[model samples]
Structures are given as structure tokens and as C-alpha cells.
Target: MDEVEKNKTVEKDMKKLVNKSWFRYWLSAEMSNSYERLQSLSFCYSIIPVLKKLYPNKEEFGEAVKRHLNFFNTEPTWGSPILGIAIAMEEEKAKTKQIPGEAITSLKTGLMGPLAGIGDTIDWGTLKTIIYGIAVTFASSGNILGAFIPLVFTCLTFIIGRYLTNFGYTVGKDSVKSILQQGWIKELIFGTSILGLFMMGALTSNFVKIITPLSFEIAKGQTLVIQEILDSIVPGLLPLCAVFGIYYFLKKGKVNYGVLAIGIVAICLVASFVGVL
Candidate 1:
């Protein structure tokens, strides 16, 4: 085929690979999760259509499927972009027949960590907190606004997810070098982490309620309330302390979650029975 015809054929193939139906497949990217490879099976499943188009021979198609089915796991939301880029790279490999399976696998593995970090920081740490914060405020007021707000947020995220998938394919292999070399990914992670911490503090203060009812006679008639004294020193002092205590235990990693939960329940029950809380 002539150069122009080859270019036209590549464009047609790429257009076919990244269509509306393909985006639907990418959206179901986490449906086949497993403990062994996590999203590896679904990841392979998402790109099967592309693989079929690129690798005509049964042996080549099988090899391509196996190559993608190795080990793959990342945040499903932002990870769609990585999937798009991988599809483009696989297309190139099929055309040139030079890129080895190891190279492709290595690329996927290397990108997973960084992409997951970015995705978790943005999606879980920042965006989720913002959405939940707003929704909870409305729900606390006994309004349906909270439910509708989260539904809107979910729709917006779906659209953004689709866009990221297409963007990844559009950027192709440069997606890795561009993200790492430019250093913006690091800045994004740092910014989102700081925001997440601030949100966590706000949630703790608003939700965690702790107070003491103990009272002592200071002199002949004067009485001192322990909770009032603690509040005077710092509002939510007990709550802050409780949070830090739990954080300390969690950081230690020696205590199981179930044991910690039971311990907290036991402590609360004892304290209430003794009238200390």
C-alpha cells in the first residue's frame, strides 16, 4: 500500500478502536476484579475489541491477550486514560511488529503506581470529600438536596472519566513521559493531600462528639464542671484526643480493626456506666 493509503488505514482503524461503544466497555473496567490480578481480567476484556482488530492471526491475538492479562491494578476512574494509551501503543506494536511484550507490560506496570497515586489523591482524597461534605450538609438538614447533589456529582464524574479515556488514547505513549517529566503530577498529589487533611479535620470537628458530665465542689458553694473546663482550654479537646489516639494505634498496624472497634465500644460502655462520659 502507498504511504497515503497506509495513513488512511491507520486512521480508520484508530477511529474504529476508540468509539462510543468502546467507551462503554472502558466504563465497566472494574467489573471483573480478582484478588490475584485485581483489574487485570477486566483490563484485558476492555481492549479485546482493539486486539481483535490489530492482531488478525489467532496466535498473535492470543499472545496479545496473555500479555495484557498479566498483572494490572489502578484507580478505575483515572485509570481509563492509561487504558486508552495502552490501546494506542498496542496498535503501534501491531503495525510495526517491533515493540516486545515485555516493553508493553513494563510500561503498564510502571504507569500504574503513579497513575494510582494521582487518581487516589484527586478522586478519593479531594473530590469525594467535597461531594460528601456538601451532600451531608443537606442531609443533616433533612432535605433531599443532599441526595440529588451526589447524583449530579456522579454524572459529572462519569463524563470526566470518559474524557480521560479519550485523552489517554490521544496522547498515546507520551502520556507517561509528559506526566512524569513535567512534575505537575507531584504538585497535584501534594495539593490534593493538603486539601484532604483539611477536610478530614473539618469532618472530625463536626461529627465526633465527646463530653464529660463530672462536677466537683471547689469550695463551700462553688462547683466546677470538667467538660466546661476542657472546653475553656480548647473546644472539642476530647474528640481531638480520641482521634489522635485512634490514629496512633492505626499507624502502629499491630492492632486489628475488629479488635480496635471492640475496644472502643468497651471503653465507651464502661465510661458511660461509671458516669465519666
Candidate 2:
């Protein structure tokens, strides 16, 4: 092969070398969780193949393995970029002998927290919420296909995670740092937050039900109907108020979800019994 073609072939071969590592990571990202070490064991396990390949010498391989075994935990899917970058760093260290093992450990430790936050916000908070909300609508209408929506989304997540793994390996850490420096990640989080709020508002209006049978006697000849007044002022004011009240308390971070649910049921039962709702 010519020089250019030969270089391309070598690059492709190197990428293939890491595929086994990536696949292992994808399969066991959360399976071997531990309270103390968290995902460190799984993380080390995932990259063991690549580390073995890179550090063929027994002493070097042992040090590389030990470095990855340090406390490491992050969102499995979204945090995948860190794995890709780690692989790149490992490869560099093996080839150049300049990048220290401690640097690799520090890179992982530093990135995990930030990436975990972003992953939790986007994947768990926004994407899953939106998907499940749509699925719930289909489910409530008795569509059996709704049951498979989450499964489909889970598959999609795997595809996304795989793509990110390859992307991180291909692009390396400089690109990731550039993306973060440009504030794109923050904008993504904000946009998703707004979309999540919109979805929640839509769900609340569609599902939450509250009405009152309250009236006030202004005079013997004329009674002031509270429901009519509320309707005139706002069509679904009671439901809105109920949803906002619950949201406020939850945001305060002092309420347990189970307690809130039971309290709501009790309050609704009392209100209905009193003929006020």
C-alpha cells in the first residue's frame, strides 16, 4: 500500500482494537455496581482488553489495570465519552511513554462528575421523561404498542451510547473540551429543561382534575357561585393550582413522593366528603 493508504489502514486497525473494550463497557456498565468502588471494577473490566493490548509487558499491564480500578462512576450511557477518551489516553501513554498513568486516573476522576451531571439531566431527566410521557398516553388508551415504546427507546439509547463511544475515540478529548468551552452543553441542558417543563405542563392539564361545588351567599335572593367565578377567571384554575402546589412542595425538597401521594388522596377524599370538591 502507498503511504497514505497504509496510514489509513493502521488507523482503522487501531480503532478496531478498542471495539472489544467498548462493547464490554456497553454490556456491563451498571451490572457490577459496588457502593465503595462504584463502577470502578466494571470500568476496569471494560477496558481490560485494550489495556492488555496496549501494555503487553506484565509490569506495565499491572500498573495500567490498577490505575483504572480507582473509584470511578458516572452515567453509563452519557458518560461513555469518558471511556472513549480514556482509551485514547491509554493508547497515547503506551506509544509515547510521556503521559503518566496518574494523568489518566486524574482525567477520569475529573470528568466523571461533570459528565454524570449532564448525563443525568439529559438522559434521565429530559429524554426518558419525554419518551415515557408519550408512551403513557398510548398506554392509557389501551394501545399494546405503548408497552414496547420504552424498550424501543432503550435500544435507541444503546445505539446512541455506541455512537458516542466511537465519536469520543475518534475525536479525542480536545474536541470534548471545545464543546464544553463553547457553552453548547449548557444550552442543551437549558433547552431540554424547557421542553421537559412543557411536556409536564401538557400532562398536568390533560390528567389532573379538580372542581369545586362551593358557593357563597351574598344575599337571600342571589348566591355567588364560586365555580362559575373561577371558570370565568380561568377555565382550569383549580387543577393548575393543585399542580403548582405539588410542584412547589417537591421543589422545596422536603416532601417524600409516597407521603405526597397519600396526602393528596386523603385531602381529595376529605374535600369531596365536605361537598367542596
Candidate 3:
């Protein structure tokens, strides 16, 4: 009975520790971003409490912290399951001394990239696009509720993150390999990619404004209008081309975003001034 009570107390403390780590991560996941290590410091900061609780020995605690501080970056909300798995593994290591420190490091490095991709697609691309699309519809009609829609989405992210963190804890380390081997994640990525592309296309058509006023005489009392010709061939062709051009430069990874923005504005201004747009 005494051992049972002790186990209960330890379990309670562990839950508290995990919750603290999750809260810290939610608040400051990107706050400590740096070019060199990116989210490493933030990840380390989030799990510090859990590590301290697990490794009471000063040297072990220091080693654990340093182990986590090595080049970690991920999409915080979706990658939160990794945090829970880390905590579970740390607890196992503290108890058994069988799990190598290198194993933990490898787990984080391996999972971060894939989870980041998933998070970016689902959370940033699809979810935000859907939410903001609705918000924009409301805003267009001067509805004050549009402002609160994003707040609701932010809350939903926290809820989803908390649930995923708990899920990782429940699954532990062994199940991750099997889960990754399955088709669900890939299917999810494919579905979300399609939805995101659809949303982006809709947004481009509605918001990206480009038109031409250029015209020339094809014959006596007949004129050829460039914008009309473009419309006849493909509606919103200019805006689509513009979007594709920007996407191309961005994918090349060499263009500075600030410079790109300035160049775009300059082109627009010049086109307007010359009556080509």
C-alpha cells in the first residue's frame, strides 16, 4: 500500500512537470529563435523543469540540458508530441539507465523535420487559410466577429497541442516507429496539400489584383485591348503569373524577402506610371 501511494505521488508530480513543460513550450516556442540553433534554446527552456525533476544529480541535469540544446527546430504546436515522448524517454532513462543519451538526441533530430513539415502544412497552410478565409468574408461585410475568429483558432491550436502531447506520452518510444511506418501521416499530408493549394488559388483570384489598360488599333474603328485578350485566354492570368513568379524566386532560396517586396512594389508603380497596367 505504501509503495502504491508513493507511485501515485510520483505519477502526480510527473503530470505536473509535463504540463509545466508544455505550457512553457506553448508560450515561448519561437520567442528564443536564433539563426544558428533556431528553436533549440526554446525547446531546452521548455523541458528544463522536466529534466531537473528527472535528473536530480547536478552533472546529469547539466548533461541532459546540453544534450537537448543541439540544433533543434520544429513547428511547435504539431511537433509537441515529440516533447511528450522526450519526457517519457527521459523518465525511462532516469529509472533504468538503459536508454542512451544519444538515443534521445537522435529521436529529436529525426522527428523534428518531418513533424515540422506536417505542422506547417496542416496548421499554417490549411487551417489558417480556412480560418482566415472565413474571417475575410466576415470582415468584408464589416462584421466585428471577424476579429475574434483568429482568437478562436489560436485557442484551438493550444487544445490540439495539449491533446497531441498527451498522445505522445501515452504512445511512448516504441510505438513511434510503427506509427511512422504506417500510411496515415502520408495520407494526411497529401490531403492537406491539396486543400491548401485550393485555398491559395481561391485567395489569389479574390485578392491579387492585376489588370492592363494597354490597347492598340487592330484595324479602323477596331481596337485590341491587352487586358481583354488576357481575359479571353485566361481570366486572372496576370495575377496567376505574378504569383507563380514570386513562388519560383522564393523556392530558389536566394531571394531576400525584403528586396522581393520592394522590387514588386517598384514594378507595380512603374507599370502604373507607364499605363501598362
Candidate 4:
């Protein structure tokens, strides 16, 4: 009787161990690795079916699920690192006791705010306006090769993310001191962000377009038009002035984007009414 009970207990523990998705362990390692990284190749939902095998019961798997289910929360550019760190932590914890999945909900609530701030100001805030600017300039001039710029940028995101994923995983098993000593995360993230800033500056120079409007005033002798006077000031100055005006309103008035969009429509209508579209 005693032997049978012991065997049953062993089987239960073994089954519990088998029930977890071991791969997610890598995610936990990666998220802790750097402020920015990417690792996911497919939607996290796709992994759920396979993940079922890793947990024998719902309660035992909650923490892992909560942490690993970051598909919608993360951008492709940062997926790998986020998933890797989540997975890595879960696996480490599994060695002793199972973590309740709901714990992830609380953890995420805390981490997401900081991550979002870092991601936006560094990645999208500065990078998007810059790189896309270059892309448009190249594309607009009918330069067929210029279309490749954004595509290349997209591919570059994947490459950077994959590299970070690998780096994080390799270091996951190590102590924090050892990992920090390598300066791998700092070097990669800082170096990349700096490069991103540089790219933004270069792109800004290429992409911004301004067109000015000129008016003509017909002289009493019908020899002069307003376009003659406007041309004397500067070509395209009107358009540049309009842009600055709108920017000032947006900043000073604290107008929301929606309000600004509505204002644009209203201005367009007024311009069309006056034959100034």
C-alpha cells in the first residue's frame, strides 16, 4: 500500500512537470535582458495548444500563461525579449513551486507603463518621424529603389529582435553580476537607440516637404499681380508658415489629435469655398 501511494505521488509530480511549456522559459530571460528586444515569430495563441501539454491542471499553469500571453501587448519589434523573460522566470520558478498565473497580471500592470514610456520616446517617438520621412522623400521622387527603405527598416527590426532574444537566453542561466559584467544588454540597446536617433536626424533632413502659396495683386494698369509681390518674400514661405502655425496651435492650445483633424477638414472646406484649395 505504501509503495503504491509513493508511486502515485511521483506520477502526479511528473505529470505536472510535463504539463508546462518549457520554451516560454526563454522569454523570462530575455525581458530582463534589455529595455528593448524582440523574439516572437508567431502569435502567442498558436502556442497555447502545445502549451496545454506542459500543465496538468489550470491552477498550476496560471502564472506561466499570464506572463507568456503577451501577444497583443507587445509590438513585433519587442516581442522576443518580452516573451523570453517571461518564459525564463517561469521555468526558474518551476524548479521549486508553481506560480499562480494571475501574478502576471499584477506584474504586467506595473511593467507595461515603464516599458511603454521607454518604447515610445526612444523607438516610435523619435524613430518613426525620422525614418518614415526619408522613406517618403525617396518614394515620392519616383525613385523605385527608395521604396526599399521602409522595407529594409522593417526587416532590420526583426534582425535586431532576434539577436537580443539569443543574447538574453544565453545569459538567462547566469547570475545577474555575470550578465551585467558583460555589458551586452547596455551596449546593444544604447548603441541601437543612438543609431536610431542618427537615422531620425538623417531622415528628417530628407523627408519634410514644404510648398508655398503665392498671390498676385493686379495693378490699376493691370500689369501687376499679387504673385509678383509674394515671390519677392520667399518661394514656399506661405506653406511653411501654415505648417508652423498649425504646430503652434497644436502645442499652445493643447489640441487633441481628433480636434486637429476636425480643424483640418473645416479649413479644407473653407479653402475650397474660396477657391484656395
TM-score of each: 0.57, 0.60, 0.63, 0.40
lDDT of 1: 0.76
Best by the lDDT measure: 3
Which pairs clash in the backbone of model 2? none
Clashes in candidate 3: how many?
A: 0
Residue lDDT tens for model 4, 171-229: 44353234335645444345445544454344334554433243444666565445445
Model 1 CA deviation exceeding 4 Å by range:
1-13, 19-26, 173-277
Off by over 4 Å in 4: 1-76, 98-103, 167-277
The local distance difference test score of model 2 is 0.79
Give the CA lDDT, 0 to 100, for residue 104 in model 2: 65
Off by over 4 Å in 2: 1-6, 173-277
lDDT for each of the candidates?
A: 0.76, 0.79, 0.83, 0.48
What is the number of backbone collisions in each predicted candidate, taken in the order shown? Answer: 0, 0, 0, 33
Residue pairs with clashing backbones, model 1: none
Give the RMSD in angstroms, all C-alphas superposed, for model 1. 11.4
User: Which digits, one per residue and each the tens of the lDDT, describe model 3 over residues 23-133?
Assistant: 899999999887557898988999999898889999999999999897778899999998998888788778867666766776676677678889999999999899989
- Give one digit per residue, the lDDT tens place, for model 1 in 160-213: 767887788888746434544575444534554555456558658988898999
Q: Which candidate achieves the best TM-score against the true structure?
A: 3
Worst 10 residues of 4 by lDDT: 34-43
lDDT of 2 by residue, 1-277 (tens): 8999997986777677667777788788888886447799999999887888788899999999999987788898888888888888787668757566755666676667667778899889988998899899999999997898888668867887788888888776454345445745445445545544565576578888888989888998899989999999999999999988988988898997678888999999999998989
Better of 1 and 2 by TM-score: 2
